[model samples]
Target: MKNRTKIALLLLSSFGLMACDVATNTSPKTDPNTTAQTAVVSEASSSDNVTKEKVETTKAEVVMKAKTTSDGKLILGEQEWVYIPGLKESFKARVDTGATTSSVSAVDIQPFERDGEDWVKFKIEHDGINSDEIELPVERWVKIRQSSAEGTQRRAVVVAWLQMGDYKAQTEFTLADRTHLTFPILLGRSFVNGVAVVDVSQKYIQDKHKE
Candidate 1:
């Protein structure tokens, strides 16, 4: 009777241990499931933060792109004479908003080097016997599309100063053969845009010889 009582107590203790082991295994599974849910919430939060940052960056760029002048600009005529004091030469220019770049008549373009810099020599038409020639260091080169031709032409550009009446500007000019055109100089939008407003009905509104 004593041996049987001892065996019965041992069996009851083993059953209790088995129940504890089962509970421990089930508790570990629940912890991993909770961790997975937390990781998913964290990943979702990070994605939302990235989207908000992009929205703020785009808004800043939009604000930067929207720019305007505070003061008004000069109103100019369609036709004006631009005088260059350095050359003592004046050119009749057609203020054209259609063209993006300004053009000047130049013939016999010869590339030369001066002071280890690239220079260009071109002749300008005048009422004088000798072909009046000008030489300057090449500022840059531009590829332009011509209305009279099919393909584009690469022309040499230079920076020069010009006077119209009260307005004076240092602008870029591209050299080209403009003998076939009525005006020797075509003052494009690059020279007049934002600074002057052109009236097509007006002519010589500003004088170069007005001193």
Candidate 2:
């Protein structure tokens, strides 16, 4: 009877140890909820990249036309009529983007003093040999270095009203000996860059004022 009781106690202890092993045998399982959250975060990151690209494209399109028209239409032909309100005169002007500063034909330049400032008198002779003496305060002087000239020619600079069609601007101009040149006035990039677009094939496209 003693041996039988000892055997029965051993069997009870073995059963309890088996039960504990079975409870601790379960390994960690990957959570389905966590995998779903990771996928959603990945999708959101892709969406953000697409939205950023769209914004950049829109910004570029909007800024592309900044240097375009301002107050009025800025279009010009190869040659057009230019009116100087200060001089009450209008003349044909050649649109030249190649040149840097606009020029007006002048001859017999005589320097003098006015209001304690440097002034100059120049004559403009056009059709039928008609000449008009223009006198104005010399704002500044520009040095002209060209391939055709023997030396640097210093010319007088002045601001004058230049009108074409409906566009009018008080733009800077330099007095030059343009008698040898074809056109009396040459409109340069200073007036063309931000003010006008030159169409090389067109000429005299703007309306001319009548007397």
Model 1 error, position 172 (Å)? 0.6
What shift in Å separates residue 85 of candidate 2 from its native position after superposition? Answer: 2.9
> Compared with the true structure, what per-residue lDDT tens digits does model 2 show for residues 78-108?
9988877756677889998998889888889
Query: Which runs of model 2 end up more than 4 angstroms from their true locations?
Result: 1-71
Model 2, C-alpha of 53: deviation from truth (Å): 45
How many steric overlaps are in each model, in order? 0, 0
What lDDT, from 0 to 1, does candidate 2 have? 0.81
Which prediction has the highest TM-score against the true structure? 2
> How would you encode candidate 1's per-residue C-alpha lDDT over 48-154 as one tens digit per residue?
99999999999988654322224556556788888876577777889999988888878899988999998999876633312467888899988888797899988
* Model 1 pairs in collision: none
TM-score of each: 0.59, 0.62
